[model samples]
Target: MMIKPLLLAGALSIGLLSGCATDANRVPEITYEAAANSPFVATNYRAADALISQFRASPDGGPLIVATVVNIDALDQSSTLGRLISEQVSARFSQRGWAMVEMKFRSAVYMKRGEGELILTREIGEVARLNKAQAVILGSYGVSGTVVFINMKIVQPGSNIVVAAYDYVLPYNNEIRSMLVRSTR
Candidate 1:
């Protein structure tokens, strides 16, 4: 009787161990660093896709200008995060065959030291006019709790009407925190 019980317990232990191994193989481990780095590109791509889905204007309507994304609290200020987001989003649009005007080459948009090209609400028309931009891509970001919320819009330059818009959020991790820090110089 004792030998039989020992054999049954041994069998159960082996089964449990094998089950754990199978589960381990099925679920790949994802580290924090990997997760953080992956979202930046993927999220921007999704943002572009979301905007494109809502866009009703013709691709040949006119060139699209992407401005540096600013902070919601301060429309004139932008951080590395804002600039990077603008670049990535613009790349996505360009990759999808949208004609995006490179604002850095154009002197019409206002630029601050350390900050990228900034197009204020009032100056949108003038900047767009100078670039002959059919639409302008503008965005702002705000931090709340452990998440950073971003809102993007494609506005018709002359009418100041939003042709497409998208709202998304990202985890407020160390990588994002570093990007949000503005340089004092």
Candidate 2:
């Protein structure tokens, strides 16, 4: 009788411990925020608007287009991040009445062959003139740790002079990376 009761008690204890283990070590659940509504994009849009305001107030302001937005991460200007930012910034600039230049021609002029880097050799102005744009918006962003530094400028095509410029810093996170990598849907 004693052995039967001891065995029963041991089995009960084992079942209780197993139940406790399941409840004690649950997997953590994480939900990432959306990229479109992220602080990074919001801050960049505001900076772009500010730069546009300054560009409009400048003497060489009419008929502008976003030429390029480069990602200086590893000095790569054609990265997914670069393209995403360029597309969004171009859209925003277009909404504000700035024209959109064809990327093929712009890339042919600015993007170095085989390196995928932007190299604006004094020929930038000539290319802009050919495109018939008075000014071109150039943008670049760099990531350091959990912060991203973004800079944008409106440059006079022929003189290569910056007529307007703006810079802003954003707190980087996974959502921002997702924004850079994924397309807007």
Candidate 3:
């Protein structure tokens, strides 16, 4: 009868739906070794240390201004990862006894709504001069095939010369992917 066919179809649909739901919940389990090797912040700290080692200028030269890291393709745009990396690198510099000028307290640098303080190559001199910064720390990042490459430079504003530079790579994991989401604000 028509009713018997309808009942069989309804049962089959429900069974298929439940099977898909179960499969959707099964995420691959990560190993303990993998979990212990998380390296986003630590990698950045190491890069900062490398830059510090190569730096010939004295820590007492003057205060250093740290700018937020931005996408290499779009210098004005930044994501959560960019801001966090800037903060971590600034902290490392401060811990190393370098006087770091806090960008949030100064309005001389260009700050976008969703992006943090960003000084273009042309505007670096003006911003550094306005803040009386000895050097400005700038960085850009690019992603390629499960890895994110970062390059940081400490530049003397007056001479527009790189005092120190460091380049590093980080694994592009889920956490990084989330942080790379462009701000809607």
Candidate 4:
């Protein structure tokens, strides 16, 4: 009888201790918040817009297609960036009545993977005729240091000409503000 009661008491204590350790309510969780002060985001867009303006002033008039249709991240994000930039720039361009090739055109850009230089030029030529584009704008967002370098290149689609380029620095990348302002491209 003594052994039976002792065993029962021991089991109860073990069960209670384990129960407290494994309680669902005690699980930890994490949340992310944007920074209070940062200028990377604002600066980045400014740089991109400046590049666009320069292309408009030039006189190449090639395919007039601005797209990020290259296979970027290891997990193909072609459509996301392609549509995002194209549409965003396209909309901004539209506000001023500037002609731009609609992104609906299904042209693929392949540059041996991550080789944006070759692929960028390829896609410019592939886009169908709408309004001849004088330049093509492209951006890349992977950096090795604290400074994130986003590149925007304006190219002549038909002749594969690089009329203008913009490489903006985003050193102030925080959750609240991003430093992606327009700089010399």
Candidate 5:
């Protein structure tokens, strides 16, 4: 009697597990649709274009060193959002016939010096000088509720004067957030 019960239990266990392993039962079928504005790339691009136009209209505008985007609120310290903004803005500037100095080398110098954050305007000017750039393009972003406000500034390194500034407000949706921040494995 004991042997029979044990064998029956073993058979049931195997049957249940085998049933669970089948793809049809394990996962539910779902359809996915392609998004019209994937990752909101166009939004960033528009902001970049606007920034370029604003800067070019200024008297102090010309060759600019694009700096990494700085978050004055300290929320995006570990996020890649700043880098994405910098790249997009720089690309737009380039497309509009403005000379752009890449930010990576200048940023690396500060990283080597152990600067915690890149919010200092004076340091930004120094970086511009190092790259032989006439002006520096620096940006800052802040989030309030479900909205994000981004501000881009063009400043002359010599006079420490802001030549132009552009502001953009965007909804803080998941797609946009993912583009700004990197996902860790």
Candidate 6:
């Protein structure tokens, strides 16, 4: 009787797993890109573009402070994979018209407000007076299965309140690189 129950459970487990493993719900892979243009990846790229635009248009902003990484705990920035991906992201930020600043070290490359400051997208000591900035962007890049996910948010300085943001997942590998290299305009 115990053997019969065990076999039944085993069969049921296999069925449940098989149901989940079907191709109908498989996630695709993603690749790194210098551009943000593609139908497959447009959703994410558009979101990022819009946020950047909003910050640029905001006159109440001080200096445009762009951040590269903020949620470091959720990512493995020390890993070789992390380093490569981070580099790619940094390059892309510049391609999109974001001013590159230093990382961690506060200097003229970054714009400042009180104790808080901007890094990456602006070199240390670069001068831009600030009553406020157009925006500050902080984001994350990660690999999910074959998919590469880039999540980011735009926030108002001083208050540190989020103004706009995005969470995008892209499939890496071939068949998508073309969409990832469009110039930021």
The TM-score values for the models, in the order shown, are 0.78, 0.65, 0.80, 0.49, 0.66, 0.41
Question: How does candidate 5 fare on TM-score?
Answer: 0.66
| 1-185 per-residue lDDT for model 6 (tens digits) | 79999999999999999988885587555545534444543554465566666554533323454553322444212233233333444455556766544343545443233212334333212332232344566666554557767667765554557777767665766543432332111
- Model 2: per-residue lDDT, tens digit, 108-181? 46555432324353666776676677877777788788987878888887888888999887667765676456
Clash counts per candidate, in order, are 0, 0, 0, 22, 1, 26
lDDT of 6 at 8: 98
Every candidate's CA RMSD = 8.8, 6.2, 4.1, 8.9, 6.0, 13.0
1 or 5: which has the higher lDDT? 1
lDDT of 5 by residue, 73-109 (tens): 6533524666667777778777767777655554434
What is the Cα-based lDDT of residue 177 in candidate 6? 41
Residue 54 accuracy (lDDT) in model 1: 93
Looking at model 6, report the run of 10 residues with the lowest lDDT sum.
Answer: 176-185
Model 1 RMSD vs true structure: 8.8
The CA lDDT at 17 in model 5 is 85
Error of 6 at 144 (Å): 0.9
Compared with the true structure, model 6 gives a TM-score of: 0.41
CA shift of 143, model 5, Å:
1.2
Which candidate, 3 or 6, has the higher TM-score?
Answer: 3
Candidate 2, poorest ten consecutive residues by summed lDDT = 112-121
For each candidate, the alpha-carbon lDDT, in order, equals: 0.88, 0.66, 0.88, 0.50, 0.66, 0.49
lDDT by residue (tens digit), candidate 3, 1-185: 89999999999999999999999998878888887786776888899999899988888888999989989877878889899999999999999999998988877777777688888889989998887888999999998889889999999898889989999987888888899875423
Task: Estimate candidate 3's RMSD in Å.
Answer: 4.1
- Predicted structure with the largest TM-score when compared to the true one: 3
Question: Which stretches of model 3 miss by more than 4 angstroms?
Answer: 1-37, 183-185
**Whole-model alpha-carbon lDDT for candidate 5:** 0.66
